[model samples]
Target: MNGLSLWDHLSVIRDPCQQWKIELKLADILFLTIAAVIGGAEGWEDIEDFGHDHLDWLRQHGDFENGVPVHDTIARVMGMLSATKLQKSFASWMQACYDVTEGEVIAVDGKTLRCSYDKGKRKGAIHMVSAFNAANQVVLGQVKTSEKSNEITVIPELLELLSIRGCLVTIDAMGCQRAIAKKVLDKGADYLLAVKGNQPSLEAAFNDYFRLDMFQQEDANGYSIQEVGHGRKETRLSLVMEDLSILGDLEYEWPALKTLGIVGSIREERSQPVKELDITVRYYISSAQLSPKEMLEATRSHWSIESQLHWRLDVGMREDDCRIRREQAGENMAAIRHMAFNALNSDTSFKAGIKRKQKRASRNTEYLSQVLSGLGLS
Candidate 1:
């Protein structure tokens, strides 16, 4: 028996082509598009250029017997692909290469593909709800929706596809619903969800319970850290309380609810003629009975999905600047970028920023092969 190839895994993604009209293999096209994107190609024409210049490099992984498809052909095929299937294949590819460890923080969040919106077509920008592993700095999976509000519904669907057992899953207030909480718990994972106006009663209840002089309270558990930078001083105070008895009537409302927590942030300018101070407080709920330090760390780790994944896509991969507006094109292209990101992030042998890695993948075939090897493509 032979092991599966990269195309074998992507073969699960159904091709949207007629039997007789097929001039290019769907796998070959997908292979070219992904390699092109990994090499910093931002648009279909860029993909074509990358393919033309790196045909031999691409041939190292795929068969380009008919030569690279034209940019328009690449665009049309990608546009016509099933966005849902593309996402599934993307997730499957990630799962094939990575796994979340016990207690690893898997942050769930959403990002919008800014330039994907088109006024002429009245099509909204594409939004993606993603599961990111903070420890590994890799995206676990993602689901697409047209609007941020749609994340509430898509989050549970996304969770269903992940192997979240024993992992600590975290999401913002958008995913603070009871059903979402239950789903996370049922998936054999613990959860830390934000509490805000969306759950007005729960928010106010935690407020009333913690009003027992949190800063001076004897039983309150907290962790504090201070930072000074850019002519400014900032301090973060993270507090956690394991008492749920204060919930009173709503005590049993949340599933496996064990801890209620809060984060207080303060910032002050150092060089201002007239000094100013800023303070803000946030509330949270968790199923795990974590200490102040553990709770605080988990909360901070959830933001890695932004700093590591979302920020990289926007700034590093130039995802927000991409103009692939055709229906499903934006989403399918986003999936390719994610595959590129994971591949770049996983190969630690080349220690450099993502931009440098992208450049090397284009300018150096040996380094490109190493990155592709991370994705089981070379």
Candidate 2:
């Protein structure tokens, strides 16, 4: 597989084009798309422009026998390609590039690709469920569902494809299902699932345990952290109880339920009045037995999927602004963004943010080649 080069790793996706009608190769198109996207190309035209401008650089890795295809042809072919095939190939490529460490936190979350919705076609927006390796700051894999509610069903499916053994998988309350918990256990990984109103009895149990009058300070381990940043001062307190007797028979329902945790956050913005300050508490259930400090870190680490993956895709890459809603195009393009993000984020030599790194890559072919080299290209 050419040491898992972008072209070789993605070649496993069967080409959707008819053999007799084929001009541009599938690998060539995908390689160009991913590289161009990494180099700050936003849409089909931008990708085509990038290809024409860097044909020589691209040819070093892919066989550009038919030259760069037109933007319309690129869009047509990309829209016809199978998103599932691309996702699988993408996961395989990630596995080749990065190794998941034992006990690492794998945050699972969903994001809506807003502009992908086609009101004319009566198709809703595409919601992507992604597994992000928090410590490594890279996307492990992703699956797209037609509706946000479908995340519960597809998350387990996405988890099925990744090598998550010995990792701690964290999800918000939407994924706090017993089946999902069991699935995580089955995958040889532990789960740290949030608890909310959806699980009435479980939420009540956690509430009762921490109730002001009934709470026993000695029964739980506690940790606290404070931060001052972005014109705000915040403090977080994490409390975890390892004793399952608190749940009585309710504990029997959750698979490998070893600990229960809660995080209380107090925030004060510089511009906000005292009354406008924020204070909130969130609950979680976990299969891993962790100390109060470890629980606090793990719970906080879960948000990296938002700040790192989702936020970067939206703000850094302008993914939500892209209006590519053609058949399978939205989903495939999302995968390409993830691929580009992984390459950019994994390259530590630049010592700059993703946006800056991308800008540099777009202007400097040498820096761009360094970025591609991280993906084992050339």
Candidate 3:
């Protein structure tokens, strides 16, 4: 039933249960939990229910000698496991399953688990910063922080765990710091970071340069496209300038800085008046010398982390609806969801959206096997 077992990678995570008291094996628990999540299980109870329903199928991959553990046992074991170890395992499994090609865009962004907060403990909701492969639609790795502001710290840690060489790492305005840019360069990759009010001087410089209408110049690379959907028409203009002279020594602060980019979007709803049209302009700094088209594609690809990864976790997986706020259970459960996502998204046999695939997998063990095929289990 398997070739490249995810359990081989998961072996790095130490079981926290005492030897004498252990009823269910760690492999049994992890495999059951992962398979359940892949079948749309939202919480520990769902995971246990899935385990009982699919015990025979699960037994094919794992011993399940003691049968499926109770929901509380699953919760306790998952809570006791180290999140860091699980994350490293996830990263390793991803490397085994997906390869990052040269110039591939990897988007880094953060999402908050809204229901993870525990008022009894006076703890706030946790924010998870994830690195997603835009081209592959897979999650590479993630790091959890207590607050969104800590994403600045968590991002570097997450980057340290990935094989991002020869890739273009993109992030939102929150990741435009000099250290972050240098981290990307040091990792043997390039960065395309958004510039906003956080970096006041840089944002001001971009505003000043763009005001001159120099994007029309012959030396600058430019591209434009129009899209019609969702009852609106959108026109996107992308511009890239390789000349760093405009930065006036500010470029020295950013390591290997080579290009500046701007993407301006004008959208008007079909029912709205022309005067009511909406326009947005975003600025970016990149170490990669990308063309206008590449810049546009890379920037647009950055939002895939939000639209594909984060949105799917919340809606398809029902992550925010679960209130598992004890100890490290929430973080570890999130890791399982990422694993499930990588499996479901990487499966080519299913030609449907994530939710549809989940529903099919829940009803048909054959389709579930197809999903596990990505993890080297058929």
Task: Give the best candidate by TM-score.
Answer: 3
Model 1 per-residue lDDT tens digits across residues 1-378: 124444556888778988699988998899888888889999999999999998987777778988999999999999999988777766666665666678989999999989888889898888988899899898777889999999999999999878888999999999999999999999999999999999999888877766524755665677878899999888887888776777777769989999888887788888775455587788888999888888878988999998989888888888989889786788888888888998899889889888889999988888888888777777
Q: Each model's C-alpha lDDT?
A: 0.85, 0.88, 0.87
Which candidate model has the greater lDDT, 2 or 3? 2
- Backbone clash pairs for candidate 2 read none
Model 1: pairs clashing at backbone N, Cα or C within 3 Å: none
Q: In model 3, where do residues sit more than 4 Å from their true spots? A: 1-4, 212-220
Two-way lDDT contest, 1 vs 3, winner:
3
Backbone clashes in candidate 3 total 0
Q: Candidate 1: where are CA atoms >4 Å away?
A: 1-6, 211-213, 216-219, 273-276
Best by lDDT: 2
Q: What is the TM-score of each predicted model, taking all chains together?
A: 0.95, 0.95, 0.95
Locate the minimum summed-lDDT window of 10 residues in model 2: 211-220
Clashing residue pairs in all predictions, respectively, total 0, 0, 0
- 131: Cα error in model 2, Å: 0.5
